[model samples]
Target: MTWQTGLSGFLAGLLISIVTAPVGVSGAVFLLPVQLSVLHVPNPAVTPTNLLFNVVAGPGALARYRRNGQLTGPLARLLITGTVPGVVLGAIIRVFAIPGPQVFRLVAAAVLLPLGLWLCARALRPAAGDRPPLTRRTILGLGLATGTVGGVYGIGGGSILGPILAGRGTPMTHIAPAALASTFLTSIVGAATYAVLALTTDGDIAPHWILGLLCGIGGLIGGYLGARLQPRLPEKALRLLLGSLATALAALYLFQGLNPSGGN
Candidate 1:
């Protein structure tokens, strides 16, 4: 790759992680547009590439969270248990099915738009009396669903999980670390699944390793900085930010799905 392309990947990862890490997101979802548009990475391959980004980018914030004593928890474990298998399943479907982008984009938008609206609404409202605790089943279900989406989209599932958890009254401190940890692990599994499939399948299943690495290096620095900054921000602001990001992504997908020229 040219120096300019490498620099663009690095800068994109760095800037995006700095903004998203505070909310427990890996920012890979946001990077999808960059990969498709700016980097011109083709479909299918872009999914694994984003998963590779999470594998490389996730450790920075996770290390910081571990140092701060927020990394180990039941939530993270449950999420992993559900997401790992789900991601594997999703990867198989992605390679074998090769679902049309328009259909996927519309479905993704349908799921995200409501969640984003709900999160934003919840953030704006006064805190109601504490909600009932999340059942293990519910968490697992969420993990499975998000993991499948993550595998297909290569987002590591944190973007979906973080906002929903935050909206449910989970403390940002707990949610951020657990979500990042889950994302890191799931990405590893998802990437591995893709790599294994690449050996047998006919299409572009392998990731763009050099670009992924460059982006990951930048994310490593930026994620740590974002985690450091998170403690200082108010929970309300963080929730709002996550909701806005989700909403923006939903809009982007909706546009892509509806526009004849987009998401081919």
Candidate 2:
């Protein structure tokens, strides 16, 4: 990659993570657009590249959360349990089954649009206080579904999971670190899966290492700063922020899905 492209990747990761890390996302969901459009990274490979970014970038915000004693919890554990395997499966599917960009975009839009709207609606409602914790089965199911999507889309699944949890009344403090942790770990697995697939298969399946690392360097800094900022933001504001981001991404994907030529 050119220096200009590397710099652009860094800036994109930095800015996207600064906003998304506060909501437990590693910002790969946003970075996917940058990779596909501005950076002109090829498909399939871009998925692993995004996962690489999550793997490298996740530790920054996680470290901050750990310092504040918000890093580990039951929610985090359950999510990791389900997402790890699911992401591996998803990577396989991405490489072998559904390699087209249009299908993945449609799937992402279908999932995110309704959930984003629900989270926004919930945020606008009066506080009902903390609801009962989600059942282990429910959390595990969510992890599996979202992780599969993440593998296909190159996200850590936090962009999807965080909103759902928030809409169910989980506190931001609890959601942020947990979702990030899961994203980090799952991305590691997802990236590795893609690497292995690259050995056995053809086409652009492996990540662009230099580009991924450049973006990750920026993400690492941005994530740490965003985590530091998260504590000061009100819960409702965080929800709205996450909701708005999801909705916007969903719209973009929906358009791309409908008009394949435009996305290319």
Candidate 3:
């Protein structure tokens, strides 16, 4: 890779991670499109590559949360338990069932579009009184759905989960730690599932280690700093940022699906 491209990626990773990680996103929510449309990375491999970045870069925010006593081990365990099985099942489906670009586009557009809109609504709507607590069934169902989307879209699912929890009036403290832990765990399962699929499917889905690490280094530092700064930022501001990012990307994906000739 040219120094120019590498530098671009580093800066982008740093900026995006810093903004997104504090809200539970693993940053691949933004990075995946950049990789595909700008960096010209192919699919299958793209998913795994993004997951690798999550694995590499996730610890900084996690560490911060742990040190701050916000990690919530029991809550994290509940999330992981629900997400892992779905992630495995989804990865298998992605590799074996809907491997084609056109189909994948439709699936991605369909899933992300609604989630993005939800986030936007949450960000804009007036604050309500206390929301009822989420049930165990509800959490597991959300986990299953998020894992499926993550497996297909090459993300850790925190971007979607974070906004949803925030919308439900969950405390940001519990939201950040719980979502990050779940995403990190799901990403690990997603990457492993892709590796196994690569072995069986006659495709090369192995991560681009050098590029992943380059972006990851920036993400690592950014995550830590962002976590440190999270409590200081306005809640509305963070929600708007993630909400806008998700909707923008969702629109782009939808447009691309509608006019393949117009896409990168």
Candidate 4:
């Protein structure tokens, strides 16, 4: 990559990090397309590079959540249990699911659309005062589903998981941290999976690794600020922003899929 490319990626990462900071996500929703389209990174490098950012940016957010007492121990455990295996499987598929960028973009849009809408609805709806506790079984199911999507997209599934838990009546306060913890765990497995695949098949992924680290640096700062501001922000507004961002990204991916030539 040229110095210009690296600088652009860093700037983009910084902006995405700021946008995602209030939430527990690593900003892959914004970063991946830029890497693929603008930076012209290859398909093989996408997931791994995104995972690198997740690894770098995730810990600080998780730590903040833990410190704030927003992370639920048992819930996080349940989410990790289901997500780990699914993430592993998803990573393996990402390497082999070479139907071209068009197909992949479509698939990504399909997965993101529903998740975005769900988040939007939850944000707009009034918070229910009484809600059922999250059952282990329910968490397992959601985790597995979200993890699989994360594995394919290299997003760590916090975008989907955060809203689901919150909609189900898990306190918004806890949802952010729980999502962060879950994403952190799933990302470990997902990144490892991509690493193994890259080594066994594609040889070197050093460029992606380097870029991922750069992205992570931005994510770290953004995530820290977001965590710090969580208590002050209105829960509804937070959800709305996250959901809107997701929806916009989904649309962009869909547009790219339909007109690959226009992307970037």
Residues 107-184 of candidate 4 have per-residue lDDT tens digits of: 788877877788789888776676777788878887888888888888877656776776667776766677777777
Per-candidate clashes come to 0, 0, 0, 0
Residues 1-264 of candidate 1 have per-residue lDDT tens digits of: 789989999999998888778878777867877887788776678889989999899988888888899987798898888788888888887777755677667766765687668767877988887677689999899899988877887876655777677767788788888888888999999999999999998877899999988888888888988898888877677667767877887898899989959765
Off by over 4 Å in 4: 129-131, 203-207
Candidate 1 off by > 4 Å: 262-264
lDDT of 2 by residue, 1-264 (tens): 799999999999898888888878668877887898899999878899999999889999999999999976788998888788788888888889888889878877876787668768877988777777788999889889888877877776655777788767787788889999999999999999999999999899999999999999899999999999987877577667767877898999999999988788
For model 3, how does the per-residue alpha-carbon lDDT over 21-119 read when each residue is reduced to its tens digit? 777777887887777777776766677878887887789888998889998556677677777787787788878887766566667777667766776
Best by lDDT: 2
Q: By summed lDDT, which 10 consecutive residues of candidate 4 come out lowest?
A: 198-207
**Candidate 1 lDDT trough over 10 residues, lowest sum:** 98-107
Per-candidate TM-score against the hidden true structure: 0.93, 0.94, 0.94, 0.90
Q: In model 2, which regions exceed 4 Å deviation?
A: none
lDDT of 3: 0.77
Candidate 4 lDDT: 0.75
Question: Is 3 or 4 the stronger prediction by TM-score?
Answer: 3
